[model samples]
Target: MPLKLQSTFPALSLFGVLATLLSLPGLFGCQFPPKIDHGRYTKLFSIFSTEYKYECDSGYTLVGEEKISCSDSVWSPAAPQCKALCRTPEIANGKLSVYKIHYIEPETVTVQCNTGYGVVGSERITCLENRTWYPEVPKCERKILAGCEQVLAGKHLMQCLPGSQDVKLALEVYKLSLEIDVLELERNKEKAFQEP
Candidate 1:
């Protein structure tokens, strides 16, 4: 009986060691998927039925599945791809002054209003990671000169002078009204600049 017990003890130890070795791979989460370029996994070691979150690089948007799971020794939903997109935004009543024609991610462009117009929003816009412009596109609006219409209307109330003098006086009034309008426009612009 003592001899039989000694023989069974060694066999039981060997069986226990074999069982631990066989289960180590699954227990320690050693199985991992392949490395992805421009992407990252949620965990270093991917275990069976483990779901991993993937992220793409800046300026590149994810085109396929965002999360993938490891099942049956294979990555489900396959691998996602990072796609590059260059989108140019349209500015209303203005045009974009870009260094390059193609507007890729992180690219910046200046918005300039047309003549006789002023910008109401941001002067510059940046391309975001999602292939869209940040802060949206700015718009240009027509600038109104303060008291310009009133000055023009006051011209009709003035007394009429004689012959050529009347024509000269009218021209002079028109010129003075134009100057006033220009000065008022400048003052308004300066006020806008000082505020904010």
Candidate 2:
């Protein structure tokens, strides 16, 4: 009978290296390395040779290579920056639901237009992996009201305006009150005639 030797050794491939580093994850650093804003380099992992790497923080991604080389105490190709996946853009006459200053990759946000305004584009946008927001932010446009000003402010108008419901509601209440007064007057008149 021939004895077989099973290889229990783990692979040191890119994923294996990363997985090993992930086990001890918290923060990373490199000796005498270039400073990258919103970014950090992973621990030195050895295969054929030891190396330094880079990764970005939450809501940011590297713009250049993740692996950097140090020669003669100088970093080659420069250190990549951790760019924001998406910046909270200002929506004129509208508002975004996200309260964060910046958003991470794959995050989506919903936009809402103020009263008396209509949206001109998609109401939602997603943060793409390419460090950009998919589909530009939507714009809010004030609807044209041909006779909005002409309509009395005390009643419902054809043009959609803020507080229009309140105005129409008040008008309805006023009409009902007048109707009650007329009915009461008529009842009094009939009673007076009968008394005479």
Candidate 3:
């Protein structure tokens, strides 16, 4: 009876291929995940690479792709940045002249209405630090200038107050202002005396 020895070349060859493929990444200098300021990413595993889904914190806006791929242990493209900005404002029947995913704080946007519609509120709105829009969102009110419906319906588009009423209201306002001024003067005098 003759004993035969089996060569492990086939198994060893497969192992060598895997080892070289895995070591190639290290040889080329594998990269760690890049740190994204004001943002975070979640790791997703893949067969030959890694993926990350990024998200900006509250009050921060992401400026790049939400998902990024890392092939051969190096991230593709550049990491996204999180910017402190206000979310886009939604205005019914109107649109902003310059639309963006987010707006810088204190920035102003122009509002435009569709055809046959008229702007009913501020034509321009400013973004605030608190992410709220100043002067509120505008609306596109259907134009009624072709007819007298708005005026007849007393929509207040045209003023029709009597002269007597206007004078009376003005006098009342003047009296209130005078009283306030007197009170303020008296308070200032008292404060001066106390300071001395």
Better of 2 and 3 by lDDT: 3
Residue-level lDDT tens digits of model 1 in 1-196: 6999999999999988866554443443436544566667564343233566777776566667878665555677887776545566666677888645457556778899998799887888887656777777788997768856665454554445557777677778878977997999999999999999
lDDT at position 32, candidate 1: 56
Clashing pairs in 1: none
Candidate 3: stretches off by over 4 Å: 1-57, 61-83, 146-196
Error of 3 at 14 (Å): 48
- Give the count of colliding residue pairs in each prediction: 0, 0, 0
Give the candidate order by descending lDDT.
Answer: 3, 2, 1
Pitting candidate 1 against candidate 3, the one with the higher lDDT is 3
The local lDDT score (0 to 100) that residue 103 gets in candidate 3 is 92
| TM-score quality measure for candidate 2 | 0.38
Q: How well does each candidate superpose onto the true structure, as a TM-score?
A: 0.36, 0.38, 0.36
Best by TM-score: 2
Question: Which regions in candidate 1 have their CA more than 4 angstroms from the true location?
Answer: 1-86, 99-102, 149-196
Number of backbone clashes in candidate 3: 0
Model 3 agreement with the true structure over 1-196: per-residue lDDT tens digits: 2333235666778877866564443443556557787789876644345567789888877777787765655767678877668778777777899999889767899999988789888999998756788888888888876545634454341244467677567557756866897999999999999995
